[model samples]
Target chain A: MAKKILIKKASGEKEIFSIIKLKKSMMSSGVASGVAKRVISQIRPKIKPGTTTAQIHRLAFDLLKSEDKSYAARYNLKKAIMRLGPDGFPFEKYFAALLEEQGYETKTNVIVRGKCISHEVDVIAEKYEKNIHAIIEAKFHSHGGGKTGSKDALYTYARFLDIKEAWNIKKNKGAKPREATLQSWLVTNTKVTGEVKIYCGCVGIKAIGWDYASEGDNLQELIENRGLYPITVLISLNHQQVRDLLHHNIVLCKQLINQDTLLSRLGFHGRQIQQLYQEINKLFGS
Target chain B: MAKKILIKKASGEKEIFSIIKLKKSMMSSGVASGVAKRVISQIRPKIKPGTTTAQIHRLAFDLLKSEDKSYAARYNLKKAIMRLGPDGFPFEKYFAALLEEQGYETKTNVIVRGKCISHEVDVIAEKYEKNIHAIIEAKFHSHGGGKTGSKDALYTYARFLDIKEAWNIKKNKGAKPREATLQSWLVTNTKVTGEVKIYCGCVGIKAIGWDYASEGDNLQELIENRGLYPITVLISLNHQQVRDLLHHNIVLCKQLINQDTLLSRLGFHGRQIQQLYQEINKLFGS
Candidate 1:
């Protein structure tokens, strides 16, 4: 099979540029040298057959750790609600686990659902009282920065997220009411287009172009200053546990209510029982 | 299996509220009754057993939609990210899909990771612009709302996020360039302690107790807004396609540099290619 181009332009005018120069412009020129140094270790002369992408990511994470440079993959949300097991593409989770080894307390899998609907919020982090945090959207494609065959693929994802976020807010009654806020982001080693700007606008999400050339915060700093928190309820907030809490509370309430109902069914016959019932009523209220 | 209980004794005696009162205070009063009133098709005493959680969520979404109420399950960030396919949670992706029939988008399995480090950001929407436009962090834990647990959990998340925003400003060279400029937020279903006044220190972020009971925009609306461009990017001045326009210029530079590199490698030795060499050099220089 022939190697596929990561980016392919159709009839529309297409242009290609040097990865180094592109990085220099987007990121400060000084940062490019550091990024290049880091990339040197990640890039292999040849790939070993049958290596899973997860393994490659793990290698990258490990390399960054050894160098003491921060890695983006290390910090993630808590894994309390809707926890993804090893089978899932928990690249950030795995990265976070490595950060934990460094004695950093990172939260994993924060469950941020749409308030109107139960949509997942991926991951979240916080400083002290302030909420200057970052949300990450991971993409796991077969090819690394390969050309996306579908037109407006990234845009579709962005729009979908925008709509989903809206639905979540209007639903979950017990959820904390937030404002119309979200700094939409896309984290993919995929090629995008100029049209993405308009498409993203149509919804309200941003398509962050994260390819080999792109450089973000390293894992150490991410883990050191910011804790990792995944967006899954199972992971971050422990939805199952919360559900259990709710269930436990409900069961206790039912028991109390049932006792009251039973006493009423019994027709308040005994004086002592009636006194006890009255006390229970006062405790539980009408 | 039996559930575990987490309780901590205070240094001194503290007032304990009745559990029933707590439940009533938190329960959805008018909404549930309204939903029950509209669904007169078949009044079953009990919901069916062995039904998947997703199915239950779908039913809830349907009921909410009928009442003009939103469904929280639909806005899950995880579900939206899953639309990208491999990067999302398998169970959530499918479960959210089931909710779609009821006009509710099942957003699930959103993969969010922090860019650097922070405590309070729920989701970092867009990362293209120099400054972070919005950061959202959620607080949902089973025991977090308890007497001791409630006070510290959210406060810690909030404080961490605020610090992160400040740190990001320093790292990213935000205006004023203090170790504090990145804004963030703290969103929780529960309220924070008044005594923990440290949350007041959150410079650019807001500590919000999502008080579902009160009326305001929820987390979903905030996320959707972040998806929108210009606003999401925090461009010093708004530009429709800030990234593309900037990237186009970068691409032009790359083309010029690539032309130069090619010219250097050609060696000017080939007779046939030599005639074009002078023209190429002049073109690259300019």
Candidate 2:
């Protein structure tokens, strides 16, 4: 059986969990068995560059269902899946979901618009008790370039908004004054340039960039540093420490996805869970 | 015609470049554009949970060639192409080539065996007036379900190495006492966990961490940041300023990639480039 612990955030929401709980859930929910099958049946050793966003989605969804494990969506998907196009990248949404499962009460895909222009953002993410934390754009690019897109892209777009001018109207209308939005992003598998830098600075927007190759590290930093949120936890944490925990979890997930022990104990119909088992098995190459 | 520049490095190697210069060489050298074309042509959208490292390599090579650009190895294939496996992830090797094209001296398929074990790292990188570096490993996994692999994975593998113990031995004496070896990485479509914070502490080996993502506003901060260069760069310039320059360059690269006029001007003839163009077009599709 898994152990459970309740965590209270500064905002007063409490979440209960434990590795054991995750392990138990993996076993009882048939997530392990299904994942194993998904690994075996769905994962392929060769994929192409122009693959569609939806294809990637189906792969993930199929793998999840195969394992009899839910996507932990109630936490991240509530916002991620709703805000993003089928092909657009879903890091923040998914990470937020992971946090949610860990008991963080947050809202993803909250829309925030320029006060006057009404330019809509894809996601306005907020942690509970925090004020409008970040304006996020999840870009799913086919290539991973490890840089932002266009030096002049933001400035050109800002020319259309004049968000500062819009903010003035809101202030005059007796609304709370707004600071310029923090860092924005051009998360793609392409690179960015210097001109984009000049434009973003002029408009008070910062770009947190990512490419396909660097997505893993970039996403982790965005959440931990909150590219927009930069609050270090009162307790100290480092990237490696967090990476270890994640690796541990991923390994365990992989194991559960591969193991037969969990499936036998869970009393799941062996045939029904075969698909999930294949997916999990494919992931670890078993 | 593309502008020409000298490949300058902290180490005094001299090389001049021009579009015509490379064009003349490609034509006269009788390089098989077909190999590059075939490599890049194979790049297409990856099916989720089914993609493999080898597939990602095929896509990147294809993408590189289609830009009318050659893999860094095109002009120097004997030393470059001979070393790689047909179906292995070639990220480290590819980037090393790019760095070489930009004027940095490089090595390929170099090995560093573990002091007390039978493990070996794939590439060892070095440049003038700087510490040696290592391109450890490249991981490809299905996107989603939160985290994928990262630099921490490399660092975890580091503790298992007997660098000091191995170096002290007569056989491994050439390894040398150095500031640090670069912990360079190439991750394709993976996500890392935010909990991975391991700077300035003794986790496994002291100060052994991977610099997988960019951190700090300037290059100086980035290098000092420990999170960005676990593996590359050979510079004595101001870190922040270098970072700023990189920031600017990245933005510019993004712009260049997105500009239809520019892409057209570049005269790349590969199908992979076309795929990139199509993907971008789809992002802004009406």
Candidate 3:
């Protein structure tokens, strides 16, 4: 216990376990700061060198579950989002829904004209009174750990500028076009690198990643607090069935419940549908 | 021969043979239009259903070889370019050299600042007196049969937009900045599609691909006419040796010939270097 314990990270690097960092991460997951401190103290006695971060994560997850289901769910936010896709499309649709919830009207896969080229934007968001529109490039890496880096940030910022140029040109052409500011955003399920953070900051790009809690509600908070668990989060729905639901553009659990008929349409039997709904309700109340 | 012949395209799509299309393609390879028509008429009897476009290309190539080595080299231009990369970096350097030849100072893999982010541009070229600078995205597909499509076009355009925004900001900040204009270009060593053509034209992107002979010398003409055959075009060099040379940024055969020391530096023995030079001299005069 007196010795500093070295724990393995997901990226295979080893670092000393720090109570401050662990507590801050838990707090981001909606656990009270006091609760995180208490949980870490309890695990302090069992701590050993060479323990993987995953094992530490497992212990934290179990303790949070024992505390409350919602606490556990919030702590599990990243893993839940990771279940969203092996591709970025479903994540784009889901992110558009998130933007919609923020009172911004959103469109997915909108082809915007640019000065030097046209761009098939992943998602475009607008809130007229705010006079701000956003061009978001949603990057979702599935079922594992990979941080969104500077490349995504640069490209996302680039797309936003192109669209903004076209927007300004159109405005100049119109007799009385409404004023709107264009914003660039990079949304991702995974964490972001320091380079991404610095570059995004330098360029005025609003980047949101899973554990990005620098300001406002990050992607994790938005999903966890809103209970916007994707259909893939339902234990009853297998990967194929989840894929089918996503294919039908029904990503959220709430969306799935309303379209029980889609379950049948996607070739699921009655018992499977019932179980899915039952799990959905248990995970997220009807 | 009495009926119209069906030719299979590289993409596995079937189409009817058109003498006009074939002749135009040949003319783009530096064959005179009149000679193209004559060659087509000469091969008219050999036209039959189910012949691949590749077979037709072979016939034309053989005829060109018999006529002149330069014509054969022009005809083999696309195939030569295809060997330039299994990666794009070498092509970036080669394209930068091309820009240099056009009286523009050039750099490869430059990080340009942007309004919203910084971009690692593939190639950048400037002619200050001309008051214009170009940002080029050099796309090279390895060994054959892929294309520069809309996705690439959109992203390349996006990167340019971001860099241009940054460029303008820097220009405005300078006490006596040159009144240079920024332009975006996408240069590929493969064929382009109708979508790429239309979108580029619509958005003012200067899209140049392998067969893009609408106006000024296209990629084929630039390489063949200038005798800038890539080091990959040397049959004497195997893939590993070519890759090693590419790693050292010796892409053009001219670059290779000038740096015979580089061949030995890459661990090639005396005879291998001699044979490579022999092939280079035969393919493109030293």
Give the C-alpha interface root-mean-square deviation per candidate: 15.3, 20.0, 3.9
Q: How do these models rank on lDDT, best leading?
A: 3, 2, 1
- Tell how far residue A282 is off in model 3, in angstroms: 4.5
Models 1 onward score TM values of 0.22, 0.24, 0.74
User: In candidate 3 chain B, where is summed lDDT lowest over 10 consecutive residues?
Assistant: B65-74
**Tens digit per residue, CA lDDT, model 2, B1-286:** 5333454222244445333343444443233566444433344333223343333434543454454333322322222222222333343444444445445676645554444332334434456466544444433332222343223333333322333345446434464544554444333223344322221122221221122343322212222222122111211112343233333332111233444454344443456456544433322221
Q: What is the TM-score of chain A in candidate 3?
A: 0.80
Better of 1 and 3 by lDDT: 3
Q: What is the TM-score of chain B in candidate 3?
A: 0.77
Q: What stretches of model 1 exceed 4 Å from their correct place?
A: A1-88, A94-117, A125-135, A148-180, A201-204, A212-286, B1-286
Poorest 10 consecutive residues of model 3 chain A by lDDT? A68-77
Write the residue-wise lDDT of candidate 1 on A1-286 in tens digits.
4332232223333333234433343133122357545644453432353434334444543554354322222211111211333232454443434334445444545555431222233433333233233344444343333433212333234233433455454535444334323344444334544444343443344444422212343332332244332222111123443333333322121133334444444343456345443433432223
What C-alpha lDDT, on a 0 to 100 scale, does residue B128 get in candidate 3?
81
Please provide, for model 2 over A18-98, each residue's C-alpha lDDT reduced to its tens digit, 9 standing for 90 to 100. 334434433432345555344434433322334333343345445554343233221122122223323442444444444
What is the C-alpha local distance difference test score of candidate 1? 0.34
Please report the candidate that would top TM-score against the real structure: 3
User: What shift in Å separates residue B39 of candidate 3 from its native position after superposition?
Assistant: 13
The prediction achieving the highest lDDT against the true structure is: 3
**Candidate 2, residue B221: lDDT:** 26
Clash totals, every prediction: 131, 85, 0
The ten-residue window of minimal lDDT in model 2 chain A covers A227-236
